[model samples]
Target: MAILTLGLATAGSSGAHPDHGGGREDFPGEGVADGSYKQHDGDEGHLPAVSRNVTLVGKAAVTNPSGAGNTGRVADVTAFGDYAYLTAFREPTCENTGVHVMDISDPAHPTEVTSAFIPTSDGSYAGEGIQVEHIDDSPFFHGDLLIHQNETCPGETPPGANSGGISLWDVTDPRSPKPLAMHVGDFTNTAGGLDPAPNQTHSMRMWTNVFDKKTYVALVDDEEATDVDILDITDPRNPVLVNDGLDLGAVFGVDQAAPTNLTSVFSHDMMITKVGRRYVMNMNYWDGGYVMLDVTDPRPGKVSLIAESDYAALDEERSARGHEISPEGNAHQSELSPNRKFLIGTDEDFSPFRIVAKIDSGPHAGTEYTATPATDSKQIGEGTTISGAVTFVGDACAPLPAGTGTALVERGTCTFQAKLDAIIAAGYTAGIVFQNHRDDCLSQVSMAAAGPIPFVFANRFAGLRLLGVPGVTEATACTMTTPATGGESTTVKSVFDGWGYVRLFATDVPTKPGKAGSIRQIDTYAVSESQDPAYAGGFGDLSVHEVAMDPENNNTAYLSYYAAGLRVVKYGKNGIQEVGAFIDEGGNNFWGVEVWKDETGEQYVLASDRDHGLYVFHIDC
Candidate 1:
């Protein structure tokens, strides 16, 4: 029911906008081998060409009845002792209950410990924010702690009323998980009111400073304008909000007082690393680039800006689209190198192609609509034009007023797949989806449904433009439901603008007391097909999703590439280079990954595949 929400920007600032919070990211990509494209069976698109330097020692396809969004059966993976905690995330409907327990003592055969599963929150969903740590210093309990985010099912409210923000449990005994905190942030009511329901959150990190010895959780709150929400979790029984809804741009912008209007920049993900006594938080902020902050004291007045990523200039080849404009900024996620030398970031571009919807005639004739892809349909493969098409607006979300069944889109009542299926059945060339003002109307997300014809998704502004309606923003709560096309002929030109990739930066950690630290992007990496036109449309999205660093080898990191598979990279002063990669014969749609070591200190990578299940691998190089 969600489309990539690439809305228009007004002004204000994260500096990227008036462009709005950055979130244009993710998808499949390029073929690695020379053989022909092998079409995948369960999932759409061809299997990425294979390559292997990582060995799959074991695999566990966790059981999860598909959510409405068709999310990965298993999301984030974290290990404590011989047991691994795998979080289940299916939006709208959480059929899988909660977290899945897996016994990984035997690395060669990872098995699910069904008896140890935690279902504290039926609606509790965790995406890339799942961590289990043995924090013996917490005042609450001297045992293992498990924390996961409850970001809710986008656009739909699930079961639990008090399960909105973050959930914490005492997992001291792998077989038993004692619930400590049900909801530990601003909670959303069943009626969508504020106060006990969890504030829609995406990613979070928990760390106990070696110096302060105080445990804290940094969360990315989607419901708040000032996204970063910090909490003191030293006592897991009751979390105290230390910094509530603090806008990173205002406090740390180049001009602290008048921070660049972070129009499109919003905090997405974060990496907490200890630099000496200072706890540095490297945040993946869309459009705002990666922002580094010092949170050693865990207070606003004490926290200081370490560095902020600036994409003012770039190598022409790295731009992908060759457009004169700046790169479509979607600073999705980031991780710092273990050696503290550099950090790698990802700009997730789900819709690598931009669709220019030009109005041919009618009341608002000749006006063109171009923004992020909004319609949540399968890949269009090789951009093409949906020419000489007549525009019809359907109520996608709900049924039209009694007897009025003429809208072209599904609005929101049915799945985009259902709508796209109808469109294809009706012989429509393509489709476009815009976000409702209620949720992230300005954010860009990559949610899709398989369809034959091309489908694109955009933000509220673009949606308004397509319907010839005036701009209805997230603030005003645009409720004008009537769809109007003004009887115009539409020409939709799908242009390939390249997919999301990685940006490597050389970081400078300030040694002097008053000196400011900084980060300079050293290089960019994308699959050859993602950069080349010859491989366009045939191969799936080559965009990188998440990266897991190898503790044993600081120079080595593992990437869970959607269709590209697991890629191993080595980085240093020489920059980053792919040393190894592994893609199953059927291709891989990996979402999240974690690196865990067994009792003998043998390191292995755990990845969550969207269509498939869990995969365990060991890096050879």
Candidate 2:
């Protein structure tokens, strides 16, 4: 069967020149915490000359203001005029919540607009698919509407079990937005369902151009076993499906670079350009970089692959030793420049550097390199430390170490054998590992079966290590703690479990200095750590997240890093500088970012924090 093809263009500044961290101004030190706390024992500081200019901006409490609590985890950001749209998984107070609207007319002072309920979720398992837009017309008729993807219908039970769908809101009134309508029922149920039956929409957009007098919105129904659906939402209250399945060329033919056995052209995220005359798509986890499809014929528009940048083309090892979640390489979030000259993508891996290919030209042509250092500079040879923890899952800890002794293990590496063997080889004590991030930690059942030495798992940040757990390995354990804390910091209660234990220390044996994977120095804290493939354990607080900038004004950028809340900066030829930042002293993570200008000539910044729920900020400080 012929498949639809879409041309993918590269956008943004080409070339992976050294990130000098330019375009930043001195940050007002008042009301801000010490920026020199050392993110990772030996990581860089909040300087104004880093490759990605991200300064810590004023941070507002997303969980509790009076109390120092948080709802960790930020996702994406959408800006419309002077407002910012934030989507978080949940909040400490709201808990597994929804979207938050923020006002950022003043970048320094951000205020909350409003928050919509998304209901509780099993961590990242259940939640909402959110996207906001300011009224624009090009290929389709248009009106004011805010559309978000729902994991399930509004009133459904077990949102986790229910499939995803779409929800429309009337944001004509910025202050008070109302739910305009929700497409539900048997047909809506099977849009893009996980079950063979399909049930939710993955990606959606409304286009307005020379084509129609009314606004036309198209949704990629994940539940619909066939094609994407084009809907005529000329009337906000009344929407009709123009075409459910737009025919495209076969996915195999479209995927020219098949480094691994992954499919191509699977409907993922799409961007409307050329005034809705063309739509570019990134088929889920595939080889075809970007596809350009002509939606002129909404019913049967032709889709073709125009340009592609393949990761496998550069690193074939990505396919063989790649992790399961992103085995085919993450063709995930991709953006194109306004001039439609460049296309940039984000790889979903913890590699020291991010993947930036020159979709346009030059030495960076089909090239991808690490955006940042994978490991700390000093820790480059003595081996990497695995102590900075966020969320640990697994069994409760049992007393040991002094009496029988306990072993500390990290979440990565599925089998507990490596840790146990290392412990047994060293000859001593009980055993325990920080639980995996994504799964509940399983106890070392077989080891305990033989009257094991208090085999247990510590699932708390405090319970993760044993700073001074005495034994033959006492020196190693003591090395992990900060000498300033007098190396006497005891374990606080675990976030998941009620119990706690001292932390442990086990650095990878030091390799040659400056070597790719060597530990060089020792520090009091870790800004970034290592990750484990098994149980997806290594994904916690080991890597540096992403930061984005405004093309017109590079100095204006947002940093949504883990633990590092929302950092607003003004970058330029000077150097990377910090303006202000908002951080949840408690646990909270910041992700995706987008800045928009509304019709009212106002600027809004939207940020998606992981799990903490959506955050709305007004940047008028």
Candidate 3:
């Protein structure tokens, strides 16, 4: 039987180091509806008594070719002088995905103003976040200079590998936003050539320098360090690349891997806080923690690694107490206070990420308290065997003879891990998982170490079944007859199938907003001890991925998970919660999220669902 890998929480308060953390004053404030106390030190005690009046603000369904698998995966969101913008990309198929626009004049309600295509079908834009700012040109400035990352190659067909370039949008009017320029310059001419096998860019940050009166857009190129590309957007229509002779790292920082043109690393998601001539760029990581870069000079600028934090070693004692982490990369997304005092890093791990608050500014800032997982708490599944050999479509185990070896399960039928975990929990150690049929021909496989046993994965259950009896090396050369048909089982077609992706979900909703008014009251829809073949959820027991707050109200947030559709959460006092979930009956899935505010303050949510195009919704009584 497989053992459960339940671990501990985060470590306790660290001793008084030199205290190089930033100050609370500089951190961005949530801007509570009422004059509630705002304490940065990660302390919730100093705040005043506030009732959770959060109500469901509704959601806007986003439709696109990528379908339901891409909901709530809304990568990045930022509010500028007078607008709120969102960005999305294609997954699975990696088709035509681009930057979308919504006017958030009214926080509660949002209007879809425009959506400009990224000007290429080479690969999905894979755009994560959006930023818009007006230059000093009054009426002429009507055109908002928008910047975003393009992480796909420029000429490759969809459903294959992805390459990318950065995109610039010209949103002079709310109704007709257009693309002004696209800078694929960085990847346009490498030694391997512009259309380098994997042509793409990852997470990017854009900012306007008050000192130089220049607008800069920085993007991290997957694989290599020095992947920071600087673009001058002085003119909204035309953009120029400033930083050169270097490499653009991955959006999520470098790890024990080589830099690739189409991988994510370095700064997955970052924020550019302007403090005078100096700009603070907080980059996320693979293991490099959060690095603060000093980009005062756009040209020939210097980058430095300021601070680093690692959850990999938060001892079982510390983890069990409260800290729990998934094997995901560190610092998925981060936001900065308007003042730039505090930096909030949201680790995209399955569990909650530690919210590090910098109390005293300038080289002596003290760090303070409070840490919670991103999703609701729940007991993880143990381990079990999974099998994809029985093609439900075929209604029979492969033509191969039924054997006594452990079963290798494929991911498509239901929640990827749940099935395997069930097998282990029910008393099986050697489980094999197969790739989804839709994946073109490439598969990303990993072994989930449930205690001491091994959980291996393959392109199909047939592969695992072959490995079961040991010494079954030449899988392509062996054949066996099935019970019904006297024919031999089919051979393994492809090893690198395109169907594997890491699915994560929350354990349970926070009883309280853990972070003051920003806490989202979670509705424990229903917990199950085993995977109901009928339900066939996603990876985690729930199958959902990430949770995001209403752009305007922290209490109101959206939940996006595959098969679960989109869930609108409302947090209230004394444990108030409600869910407005729109599910897909035909296997559609959700993965990303972003709230676009219309001119009237009304909020509109955009989500990427697999098979289901982008879904748009609203939160009103």
Best by lDDT, which number? 1
What's the ranking of the predictions by lDDT, best on top? 1, 3, 2
Model 3's alpha-carbon lDDT is 0.39
lDDT of each: 0.63, 0.37, 0.39
Considering summed lDDT, which 10 consecutive residues are worst modelled in model 3?
15-24
Q: How many residue pairs clash in each candidate?
A: 53, 158, 132
Once fitted onto the true fold, the runs of candidate 3 whose alpha carbons sit more than 4 angstroms away are 1-52, 63-88, 91-96, 103-122, 137-142, 153-163, 183-185, 188-198, 223-226, 236-238, 244-265, 315-318, 321-329, 338-341, 350-621
Cα lDDT tens digits, model 1, 482-552, are 46543235566554556678778888876433356988887777766666655456566567778777776
Ten residues in sequence with the least summed lDDT for candidate 1: 29-38
TM-score of each: 0.76, 0.49, 0.50
Q: How many angstroms is residue 160 displaced in model 2 relative to the true structure, after the best TM-score fit?
A: 13
**CA shift of 251, model 1, Å:** 3.0
Give model 3's TM-score versus the native structure. 0.50
Give per-residue CA lDDT, model 3, range 80-181, as digits (tens): 433445455443334546654545455445444445333334545544556667666322345566667665422233333233456666665645667676
Whole-structure CA lDDT of model 2: 0.37
Ordered from best to worst TM-score, the candidate numbers read: 1, 3, 2
